[model samples]
Target: MGLLSNRQRSNLIKSYLYILPAFLFLLIFTYYPIFYAIFISFFRWSTDYPQKVFAGVQNYVEILKGDLFWKVAWNTLLYSVSTIFISMALGLFLAVQINKKVRASGVFKVALFYPMMIPLAAAALIWLWIYIPTYGLLDHLLSGLGLPTLPWLNSTETALWCIVAVGVWKHVGYYMILFLAGLYNVPSELLDAATVEGAGGFHRFWRITFPLLSSYTFFVFIINIVDSLQSIDLVYIMTQGRPADATNLMVYYIYQQAFRYWNMGVGSTLTSMLTIFLLICVAVIFSTIGRRIYYEV
Candidate 1:
């Protein structure tokens, strides 16, 4: 009896030991920071101040009244919608094209996924060079073709769209893999049935392929939106929110306010706002659009 009790205790100890590292990591990295941010959000906290004074909801009120906050929010929404739609469409198209039993399909898949492997900073730098007004590859090619070179990053009107285009180019390959996985799992019998019913190519795709890929589409949409909303590295490296802050995304603005400006209280408020917005968006999507996602056993 004594030996059995000792063994049971030892097993329990070992089980907890196994989970200790993960628990420690979560406590330090996730929970701690989350609570810390929440605590700081209600106060006028700063490195310069030895003691933080409680400001109640002043930070929130101030941020709400700030024009820059609204501007960044609008920019973030525009970027998210444009990037998500364009990436999903391009990814689905590429997935379908590559799913075919074509010559060099494996090579094509590798080539398509290559962009996703590149680091965001490196990719942005490369795009910046391509978008340069003079002596850049794109501008040079356009000039050679007798077409006028348009300002890309230099113009407020074009800067946001240009950044979105780069984002699509960089991320389309990653989402293509998601779409390809979904396409592969689609039953061949479905296509055959559609064909037997005299469904044309477009008709079969619309009636069959798309409906079956609904889950994949929905997943890609969520991921793309989240990623687009959180995007900062590429925009920071390429444009630095220049040309009248055309590309000033929410995350970027938050980083600037919090770290650069040392406006910790405002930064915390913005972070909370972003978190709430994301939660609300996710909830709405799941409650409404997510019902259309078809899960295959």
Candidate 2:
């Protein structure tokens, strides 16, 4: 305290003042809501109840014991895994092809990223039209080839996969762009040295390019996993969790409990569970895969 001069103290106070707005914004909008929801999960507050009643972990227990919740959890898992892996693979493949300076690369890049320019709700609506039976684009194409058309969005067996396809189509472009950026960051010198050593394309990519891209790959996985888990706009616009709740996801289920059904306690409990699940996912990734990411000096 005695070492700080008046001028230094003024500068320090100004720095704190500058950051105070952002801190207050996060506290009010983000942290407060999260804590409030967790607190609400410990109580019973619904339309049937005249007043809030402390219920302890009964809400959590009831939710866990419900078959619908388990079904929804399964749907969410399938959606997340399918979208993450497929999107990453396609994105990386497209990025690698485009990075080779293919003819009209600029045009191809624009076309690839075009989907990302559309909002998720709009994309869902567009795919909904394409999935409509008989008159839909997909059905028409299948019929033209003398193949039977399956109900894309109306069948329980295919509805979740249909939504998963839409998710992959929507976000693969964004992932491609990120991977493209990472590709540019890979050192050209290393690739050239590998080529001088008689390394073929496969060996060079497997031994050099891919290993160097581990950090970007890890980053994309984290982002895609979170996105797949929380994604609800498409399900909201297209399926609304129809076809026997086959497309119902964790976030959408929480929204249903909190808003549509007016079961705030259960909703909050679901939200807390989702938060914990996300934390565990991130922790596990950091502990395992994240340890191997290579950093450039």
Candidate 3:
């Protein structure tokens, strides 16, 4: 019936003290900017503004009316879907190969995981050099085989895809390591039981191993979705959304609107839209995969 005892109060105070710095950090660096973005999105806030005019949903309406918006939206969707699915599959294949306890697995793991250690801009630059048309590495190889060479980053049809391939290359290693860890944790007893039941390799994988990696797959899915949505550095460095906006993506579109064009209101609206879209995607992912996760405990 009374207030907390002295020891309980002291413990509570200590817990609060331990968490206070992290909570404050998130408030300043993460939460505040999101709220501020939403605030400015509703108004005609510009670099010249000391005071702003309220615009409601006009920015959203205008963006919806534009043909370019939909073009860029389709571009973004295509790139994201293609990059994530292909990269994840490649990663899974590599992980399974390496997990076979083959000779020199340590070396193989390092080779596969090394790409993630490189910065994205640096990787993009390297791919840029590789993608140059006639004198580049790709064309050089094609020439060796007596095959005709095609424009890579120079053509609209291939520029976006070239960048997407670079993305898959850069991220596949990281996802491979994640899948490798999942494979390592797959219960030995379950595999043994499946083996004793005369289950072949494909059957064991489909019935046992793959389902056990559901959590890892879910994590990879979310990470790839976010990566795909926020991906701009590669596109910026490689193609700059050029060749008639063939590579235009939503995040880079927001960047161009906000910084290059100095249209803060529209930029903020685009930001809000991207946020909403990603949230919906996350919800859908959870709905599809949430209850299927099997904890090892």
**Among these predicted structures, which one has the highest TM-score?**
2
Error of 1 at 107 (Å): 2.1
Greater TM-score among 1 and 3 belongs to 3
Ranking according to TM-score, highest score first: 2, 3, 1
Better of 1 and 2 by TM-score: 2
- Tens digits of per-residue lDDT, candidate 1, 42-84, equal 9987776547899999999988898988898899989999999
Question: In model 1, where do residues sit more than 4 Å from their true spots?
Answer: 1-24, 47-50
TM-score of 1: 0.90
lDDT scores in order: 0.89, 0.92, 0.89
All candidates' TM-scores? 0.90, 0.96, 0.94
Worst 10 residues of 3 by lDDT: 288-297
Ranking by lDDT: 2, 1, 3
Clash pairs, model 1 backbone: none
Total clashing pairs for each candidate: 0, 0, 0
Q: What are the per-residue Cα lDDT tens digits for candidate 2 across 145-214?
A: 9999989998999999999898888889899999999999998999999999999999999999899988
Candidate RMSDs in Å, in order, are: 3.4, 1.4, 1.8
For model 2, the stretches where C-alpha displacement exceeds 4 angstroms are 1-8
Residue-by-residue lDDT tens digits, candidate 3, 1-297? 149998999999999999999999999997888778888788876676646889888888998999989989999999999999999999999998999999999999898888889988888888888888988999989988999998898898888899789889889999999999999999899999999999999999888988899889889989999999899988788777887899989888999989988889889988988887888989987887877777671
